[model samples]
Structures are given as C-alpha cells and as structure tokens.
Target: MFLLPVLLLLSSCQETIESKDWDTIEMPRVSVHDPSITSVTEDGEEVFYIFGSHLAQAKSKDLVNWEVPFQTEYEDLDNNIILGDIDKNLREAFEWAGKDDADSAGGYSIWAPDVIWNPNYKWKNGDKGAYMYYYSATSTWRRSNIGFAVSKTIEGPYTYQDTVVYSGFTQVDSTDGSDRNTHYKNTHLKKLISTGVIDEFSSNWVLNSGTEYNTDYAPNAIDPTLFYDENEKLWMVYGSWSGGMYILPIDEKTGIPMYPGVDSENQGLIVDRYFGTKLIGGYHQSGEGPYIVYDKETQSYYLFVTYGQLHSSGGYNMRLFKSDNPDGPYVDMKNQVPVFSSTDQNSQYGVKIMGNYQFSNMNKAYKSSGHNSAIITEDGQWMLVYHTRFTGGESHEVRVHPMMMNRNGWPTTLPFEYVNNEYFVSEVGDKDIIGSYEFINHGTTNDPKVLPLSTVELRADKTITGDVSGTWDKEAQSSFISFVIEDVHYEGIIVMQQDETKEQTKKIVFSAIGDNNQTIWGVKK
Candidate 1:
C-alpha cells in the first residue's frame, strides 16, 4: 500500500510540472515621437523615462508598461510641462525658431529632447540635477538651434540656460525680424573666429545661400544626444540632413561644450570648429537622430542613425555602426564607412537593423520604426526603445525590444516586443526549436514598403527549408546559433517568447545578423 501511494504522488508531481505556464503580462502603450530614453531611481525603484518631441514625457518602472506624466499640446503652450510659462522662459529660443502660428506643421517646433542625470551639474545651491538638451527648429529643414535646461528632478519645471548652437544663418535676418547674423555672432561666431575656424565674420562665410548651405558644410544643429564613454567624459552628438552629424566634447562641470580647436591634420571627416567634427551624412542626405551607446561587454561604441523620411509613407528605418573610439570612424559590418562627401545613397551604407515589417500573426504592419534610444539593464540585458507607426494611419506607439549580442559582437533585436522577464532564454533543446516559422529579412533598401513574413521550416536534422535554404545548429547548452543560407553566414541567439498575435501562447524565436550586415528575424508558427 505504501509503494502504490508513492507512485501516485510522483505521477501527480510530473503532471503539475508539465502543465506549468509561462508568465504573461499586458504592456501599456504611450505615443512619444523621437523618444529619447534614460533611467533614474525614484523612491528606491528604478524608473525608465522617455522625453520626446512636442514636450512629451513618460515614465515606467517596467520597460513595457508606461505612464505619461506630462504632455504639452502644440496649441496649448501656456501649460507647458518643462517651462511653466513657455512664452516667458523660452522667449529667446522662440525668437529664433518659433512657428508661424499655433497650428504649424512642426507642432511648436521643439523636437528630440535628451535628458540625463548629471551628478556634476552644479546648481545655485551646489546641488546636482538633470540636464535636458533640446532643439527648436522652424518649418525650414536647415533652420534650427540646440539649447539646454536644468531641473532638480527628471520631470521638471526646468530653467533655460542659453542657446548653444545655431544654423541656417544668412548675411541678413529673415522678413520675420529673425536676425541670423546677430544670433550667429552672439552664439558661435566669436568662438569660431577665436579658434581660427574663420579669420573674420564676412557675408561670404556667415551667409548660408543656395544649395551649398544644405549640401556642403552647414550643420542643421538639431537632434542632440549626450553620452559618457568608458572614461566617464561627457560628449554631445548633434546634427541632421544639412551637414550630416557632428560631435563635441562637453564639460561635465560647466554642463557645456568644450569645443575642439581646428583639425589641422585634416583627419577623417571635416571638422567645423563651430559645429564640431562631422561623423557622417552630408550632401542633403536623409539621415537624422544620431544616438550612441558604449557597450562594455563588446568594448565598442555603437552609433545608431535613422535614414529616409519620418512620415508613415517615408521609409523610415534604423541602421547601426560601431567604433573603438567614442567619436568614431564608425563602420558597418561590410567595412563600409558612413561618411558621405557627395550625394547620399543611404541604402548603400550602414548595417540596416530594422525596417517596415509585418508578421503573419499581427493585425497590422509596422512602419517608420526609427529614431531609437538604447539602454542596458541593471542585469546587463540590452533593450531598444523607439517609436513605431503602424499602417492604416499616422498613429504611433512606443516599443521596447530586447537585444542580444551575437558571437561577432553585433546586437540583434528579438522578434517580438519585450515582456518583462517573460522572454528570457532558457536551455532549449533542438526538439523544442524544430518547427515552422515566419521569417523576415530586413534588407538594406530605404523605402516605405513593408516586408511581410514568409513561411519557413527548421527541421530536426539541422536543416532549414521552404522560403529559404539553410543548415542550422545550436551550441551545446547555450542559446547561441550558427546558420548559413544562400551563401550568407549568420550568427544569432534563440529564445522562447510569447507569440504577440496569439493569446498566451509561447513560441520559439530567433534573431540573426548575416555577414552582409543585414538582419533577419524569425517567429515560430
């Protein structure tokens, strides 16, 4: 009788273990265009905060579920979140790049603000606070200025400091009483002359006229982002279509740029003492929103930039490049440099990480997935934060995707949206991973076309078939995978995640990067 009872107990325990379900949670959504993310500790709990265009701000304890605390409408600027009285606090910036009316196309024209907790930032009372670097741009693409503000807290009633950089200046002011030469002299001309960028301010040098202003050497002075390298030295990278991207070393103590002297040696890209050193994108190239993150594990700084236009139909997509130095000669996997001296053929440069894509299980396709910010979690897991507009309308929402570094040190984003601690890779066996899958190869084409998923199969005999032909193998007791398809060698990782289109169903997934610098994603079906 005792033996019979023991056997029944063991059988029941086995059944319970097999029937255990994976934890599933719903992710809350918020829309913040050009979202720039950072983290802070609040009340002993870690919170992720994203600050974006139009003075939009949101925070979250878990990366997936967000709560928007402050948002400002374009028409209603009286109740601004950062500036209590926008017309009073940011009067100087408005005088430079304000919209024509309340209902302008740029929506108040404040775009892509990046916030950071600067411990070295000295306040009136000598206490440190958060620094917010933002840009104000007019409807004109090249007309913009980048400024900064300070606050004791992350969500703040910030006080404007000054406009640090200016662009789109001519010999005289515009008809709207916007004096370009005066603003340029007040902000950068003095330094430029002092540093020998120019002998003296003349109309030929100060005036931005014709196609040369947008194509040759003028930086738009927008999309500012800040980061500290391995040495903890602060640096800012900002610019856009007009003259590509530029970087400046920042003074941590003063919370301003420690602008470099003239690049007499004529190094990599041209160095404009006023706008810093050019990284990439010139000749009216359609690239913007440059963000850089230093990965300790890889011992490299990864530079991410978006190409094409940002609208629903404008082929917006994200690309990646890596460098050994902070201010880099960043190169893609194919060893191609992103520096463009002449006309821009963006699709021919950089490692395209993501583009407009749709899975078989999704209700709608995703487009314009660009302008991203990245963060490494306390546990050392990498996560990507960006705004994605879906098809059917211009509506957008924030998405957080977990990323894994491949054997080659390239980061590959997972196939599905991240669910807090629910998508961690376990010790999966070959039998569990062998099945049908929907595959998406994110090509290097920069267009508004959405690539739908195609059916593929991973057989138990280490072979892949159907839409593509490949041989695959998983490392012993590891999530790392190696495969080859159509002469392209890929290295990646595999994990089990929730099938976003299906309710509560767990599925196998994989993300890999090929030697050609293109990324591929798969979702088990």
Candidate 2:
C-alpha cells in the first residue's frame, strides 16, 4: 500500500497532480547498449503498450510512468500455460536465447521496429492484423535488411517475418554527389538487367558521411517510419549514411517502399526515389525520428525529424517541417523550429518551468533526447514524448510530458515538478450552462501498461473513492463529455467520446480543458 500527503480541496494545484502509488511500476533499464524504442501501441482508449529493445513495456491511462510484463507471465511464480500457451512458449524462447550463444547473437540486432494495427483485425480469422516492421543488422552492423513481425496484439510475443527491401547500399561515403563510379555504377548495371535504360540510379550525397561499422555506408540509416495520408497513399521517410534523407512511395499492397532494398537493380528507384532533387534546396540531413501527424482539426501535415548525431556535440536535436503533401519536400514553418531544446526558457504554464537552464551553451543533459513523438490531446492540445536525463548517466530513457503550444504553433514542455504540485477542479455546474464540478480529490493509476497514468498505480477495482465534488454533462445525441469541477473558478472541461468496443465497459482519456475561458486548451488526463 502507498500513502501520500493529502493535498486537500486545493484550487491551485491544477498543474501538479500527484498520487504516490504510481511508484509501483519500475522504470525500464537504460543503457548505451543496443536497446531502443521503435514503436508503441495504445488502446486509443487508455493503455499504451510499447514495443522496443528486448521486452515490451506497458503503461497506464495517462501515458506517463511504465510497467513491464503487462500480462501475467507464464514463468512467474504462480503462472501456468493456461491462457494460450503463448506465454509458455515465450519462456522457452527466452531460456533458449540464454543458453544458446549462436541463437542469442546471430540475427540483426533487432533495429528500428514499427507497429501498425489493421482495422480489419479478427482474432478467429488469424488476420490479427497487428504488424511490425524492423530491420536486422549483421554482427558487423553492415548489410542490414528490413524485416517484419506480426502478432495478434501490439504488445506481443511477435513472430518474425522475412526481409522487406534489401538495398545493398552497405558501402559508406559512396555518394560524392557527383561520383559516377561506386555503388551507383553497380546500381545502374543491375538496373540495366531489370528495367533497361528507362531509369538509371539517380542520387546525391549528404556531406560524405561515414559509419562505425567501417563499411562507409551511413550507419545512421534505417528506421523507416510510415504514415498514410488522407488519400490513403502510403509515404515512408527513412535514411542512413552515404546518402542523406530520402522519401519514396511505398507499395501499399506489400508495404515495400521504393528503395533499392539492398538489392533492387531497379534504376528507377535510384532516380525516382532519390531525395536530393526532392528536397526544397536540400534542407534535411542526418534526419531521424520521423513521425507523420495530420491534424484532423486543421487538415495539416507535420513531419518531425531529429537532427545531428545522437551523442556528438555537432548534432543532437528535434526540428519539424510541414508539407502540403505527405510525399515531401517538407518546409520548416518556424525557422526549422527547435522543438526539443536543451536550454531553459520561460515556463509553458505561468509557473517557472526549468531547473538547470542553459541554451546557447547547450549541455547534453540526456545526450540524445530529441528523437521524439507528439500526440494531440483529446481536447486538441499536444503532448510531446522525449526522454530526460537519468541520474545514472543513461541517455535514451524517455518520458512523456505535457507541452503548452504558443500562438505561432510551437510547444514548450511543462516541467516535472509543476505537475507534482498543481491541482485541477472538477465540478458539477458552471456559468457555461453546465453542472457544478469541484476539484476532484487526487487519484492514482489502474491500467497496467507503459507510460503510467495518474502518476500512481491504485487498486484495480477501486472506484475513484477520493471524489471531492465534481459534476459531469453530456447530450444524448452528441459525442462529448464535460466535467465541471470547483478547484478553479473556471470549468475544468474534458471532451471525450466513448469508444465503441466489443466489451461494453467504458474508459475515459483526459482530452482538453475549456482552458482560457474556453478559448484555449488545458491538460485533462
């Protein structure tokens, strides 16, 4: 059991909501080793199940703190192979990996994973439509090939699929932006055998990059993130070394993009898929962390990219560009706005935001924290996902924090301490023709998944026992839920639509508050 200081019917603790129980979930181990987070899947209802390095991590309703082994493991003290026998099989696999050196070290060190849920997923049909795409690298980290995995659920004991496109672009520094000799020559010769002279390998270089693998190809390449446009055409943005950032169309049917795939002699790929001519005056370089976000509210396109080498001082950042088309030439609207800065600035919320602040002399608190992702809140606000520094010097350990967007449409992070101290009011009636809502007493997490919710885990069957006077409203015909609480004079508005699930149970995600007297948005869940 956990205990906490009771922050009574406080009206001012809105930004700081704390429940001690969340400490139950352990933090994922961080290291400079080959671990990474490629993708995460949430119910779109509440829980977020993240797929990464070795094991899958789960989180709570708020997507903050995280937990592992979301489901009861078969190898645990009290378990049995009673469910689907999957847990048991996974245990065997783990033991085999432990004992079998050859089995443990051979495959591509599982790099750049991505997961997608098929709308048509059906448990019985076996088309559980949850798919993942990741690349596997040889021990030398050269000749890496994209591979696929599939599972019935996002947090899976996934079954690995085969290679995607094997572009043998292994040699590094091959692009002089003018060299006709190296890989491109071999590439064109192969193209001659496939599509004839209709197309030749066409491409350029990004400042002659090199890799740790000594293969000369950009080791930074790979990690192909995908997104679909309103038109449903698939767009994939991925890059490594030798060549710079590249964007090409993916064969939607097969999920294969237009890369040479380490082998395709298709000269057209080299030509039609080259990124240099595609970029508007060559703006993107050493790009990583590509996420495509379409604002349904505004119908806009955003492509987020990470700049600089992860640990190198010359690079280390997050920059975004927008485009009218999913197949970019993306443009930086706010002067290539730096979304994740190492320096401190004015607080996002009125309260002071940072602790150790320094910019122009940017220090690497968490050397490479900018390969980030953002989520639009239910209320239309945006949440940024980036890791902060660990006390023990682990760099990539990530955390999700709420961000406040400026008028120019950029965001500043809400500090960890602020959320530790604020209180939000939930009432039943308000002047906006609603019910009175009071500052509902603090609560804790219930869902067991990655990115803990409520900042604390609570009794699973608990029914919000700490209610401090709150009211709710909804019209039978519409899709909105409103909470009017009394902690603050204004209504702490929350707008959520009940999800249509096979199970009739209801779940709530904090969306947006009718912040700014109903003009701007505020944090909810």
Candidate 3:
C-alpha cells in the first residue's frame, strides 16, 4: 500500500539534468524585484534581458554578467516609467472602469513586466516582434490595470498600447448615471448569471466595497503573466491577494482578453474563490505573484507562486504546482488541492522550493526569496530568476539559480546561487545516506527570522536520530528516502550540491516535506 504511493512520488521527482549544463556562472549583484527574463540572439551572440518592477531593465550576454543600458539598438528607452506616461487619461479611464487606487495618487507603480515575441502580430505594425505587458497601480490591493506596450526590439522604448483590463471595474458607471454600459450587463456577465452566482445584475451589485479589498467582484489585477498554451492559444494568469488568482483567454491580435470589455462577476471565478480554479489561497493568508511556464519536454505546466508576506518579514517564499493543462486545478506534491476557505491545506499544498536560506560561503542569509520567473535557455538551461534580500539588508537583489525537476516531476532549486562551481549527481546507497546533516524547517508561519540550521544525524541501521527525532529508511532501487520526524512522515530524494568555498567540495543534500506540510532541507556537514 505504501509502496505504490512511494513509487508515484519517487518517479515524479526524477529529472534529466546534465552535469555539463551546470556552468559556473555568477549573476551580477543588483537590486530589482519581480524579475522577468527573455533571451534573444542578435548577430550570432545570445543575450538576455531582465525586466522588473519600477520599469527596471538589465541586459546580459551571459545570464550571469549584466549591464543596465538605457540605449539599445533602435531607441534610447526612457528610464522613469510613470503611469501618466503610459496613459494620459488615468483618472477618467479608471473611473470608467470603476476601480480606485489603493492610495489617492491614482496608481503610479509599474510592476512585473512580461515581454514576449508575438509572432502572429509582428507584421501588422511593420515593427519588431516583442510585446510588453505590465501592471500599473497604486499600493491599492485590488485596484490595478494590465497595460499593453509594443517595441520593435527587445531592448525597447515600449510604446504604451492601451489598458487591457481593470480588476475592480465591473460596473462602468458607479456614479448616479443616466444610462451607462457596465460589464455586468455584458454577455460574459450573462453567462455568470446562468451559473447562479449573480441572480439579477444591478449597478449596485457591481459596486465593490470593503476594507480588505475582498468585496470586489473581480480578482486583483496585479502581477500579470502571459504565455501560450499547448494549442498555441495565448492566455493570461493574473491576480493577487483579495480574490486569489484567475485565468483569462487572450486575443492574440489585440493583446488583451478575448472578451475584453465584458465585466461579468465570472471575471474572477476561474481560480480559487467563487467560480475559478483557485490556484493557491488561504484563509486571509498572502497568495500572490503567479507565473506559469509550460515545459514542453515534460508536457506539464508548472505554476510558480509566492506566499506569505513579501517583505523583510522573512515570511515570503517560492512554491510550485504542476498540472497537465494550462487552466488547472493545480496539485502539489501531496496531491492536495488548493482550497479557499481553509487556511491550513493551501499553506501546505505546493512545495516550498525557495525561502530564507544560508549556505557555506555567504556574507549573510538570504530572506524573502520569492516573486520569481523561470525560463529555459536556448542551450536548455533551466533557470529561476528572482529577487532576494540578505539578512539586515534593506533592498532586494536579483539572483539566478538552476531549477531542475525531480524524478516525480517536481522542481527544486539549488542551495547556493549560480557560481563558478560544479555539482555532482551520484548513485545513492545506504553508505551515502548515512551522515550528519544541517537541516532547517521551513515552517508555515509569518515569522520574520529564518530558522537557524540544526544538526541531525542519520544512522546506518535504519534508525534515525536528529535535532528533532525520527527513524530513517530508503527504497532499494531508488534514491527516495523517508523518515518520521517527531511523528510527521517526510519523504524526499538525496542529491549532491557543491560547496565552492571549500575547494568546490561536494556534499549530499536532502529536501523533503512532512505530512503536516512543513518542508525540511538538509545538507551534509
């Protein structure tokens, strides 16, 4: 009985990682947040550009070395990307959409810029092939707009196209109006009415009111991400906090939702709340920063999300979920589905892949390692581009690390950032598994301080003794190891990571999660 589930978990954890692909490259030290990376080949040399919050862009020939160049090939792109620059009629437009900024400033911040090559729409304007879509908003939780911009080149002076969709803009005319066209009276809204969510749509029904930004009919429109599905259909997954996440079909030609102006209550119904698939949310827990990457090789769409507070509080961490389809009911390692009302299960659903961590040769421990993006390089290197703040540091710095899938199709990140060191993947046996290790428990809490590494020991006699307490065992044919730590069963695989500070020394590492949804990471000491 236990063997079948163990086999399923172990098989999903294995991934084909080439040792040669682990190039010893060091990414530049820079402060940026919500990074999105794209690669382009110009004149036989491949280059990558990283875009982030506050309209920041950094260019790199190799993923490691970077330069913040404003002037590219075609244009000298402007630095300060203000909201007024993108759209002049900000107040009129947002009032028409029925959403207000978190602050009275009417939305000024640009965040999580996603740039991609739109082949279908490239020739229409006689320009280059890239389109950039970004979020502009105030500190307001639910008030935001996903705007469109186009550039002939990757490094762009991106021309603001138009506002795609406003999150809280359901009733078009909230003020005392004569006759106004609202999204509630639209066809999509009619469909949602048929689903029994909204019985009879009134202008008052569309109006949102709440202190927590949860009274809105739609999902919070921040953190926009764009990607094409297996059928070549362009789709977007967006939302943060309040109403959880949502998915909308994108019209390739217009660079917006297929049903653009329709404001049905069904707008936010696709993910984890009223009517949506509910990617990941908890009872008032922070569940934001949604990015989905479809790995063609695995035939699975991997959903990467950040949870907890995304501040220096050290609660922020990156987690993962995978599904066979793009619009999913995504499942995590334990096959637990994300629930909206329950704060317990969703907190433990996805594997906590990255968090406040410390390695051998670090000046300080890394905290709040979330809000990330992933890409497969032209040379087939899988990388996670993210921002992390060190202990006692005030600003967030960008970092890139290799992301490899396990035999069970789950992804795990390396302990250290990408540096000039080689990692090893050796066959594991009982001898390799028995050792003293430094372990840290990524507990599901909002604590600001990262847990200190605790020492644990694994005995060769199938008995376990550690900082906590447990019995250890391993499968005969695979590297799948499990142990009971304080009555909570934990399972994971043994892999090797190199310590560059010690003559590039290699150490066995284990990353596992308990049945209670807590994650345990260990490195051989």
Best by lDDT: 1
Model 1 residue runs over 4 Å out of place are 1-27, 70-76, 101-107, 171-183, 190-214, 265-267
**TM-score versus the correct structure, for each prediction:** 0.88, 0.50, 0.76
**Tens-digit per-residue lDDT, 47-159, candidate 2:** 44444323223444545345644332112212211112222322222221111122223221333445554443343454534555443321211233344545554544455
**On TM-score, who's better, 1 or 3?**
1
Per model, state how many residue pairs clash: 0, 60, 23
Error of 3 at 117 (Å): 1.8
What TM-score would candidate 2 get against the native?
0.50
Model 1 residue 373 CA deviation (Å) reads: 0.5
| Alpha-carbon deviation at 434 in model 3, angstroms | 3.1
Candidate 2, after superposition: displacement of residue 445 in Å?
39
Q: lDDT tens digits, residues 1-525, model 1?
A: 000000000011111111112122233778888889988877887778888876667778888787765332232245555655555566576556554522233234677889877778777776765565554544346666788887766677677877777776654443223323334544455676776755554332343442123335667778899999999988898888766888888877667776555443135666665577788887777788899999999999999999888778888999999988888888898888787867558788888889899887788888989889899977788899998899988878889888899888988888788866566577778998899988999989997999867888999999999999989988988888888989899999898877665474677899898878788898887
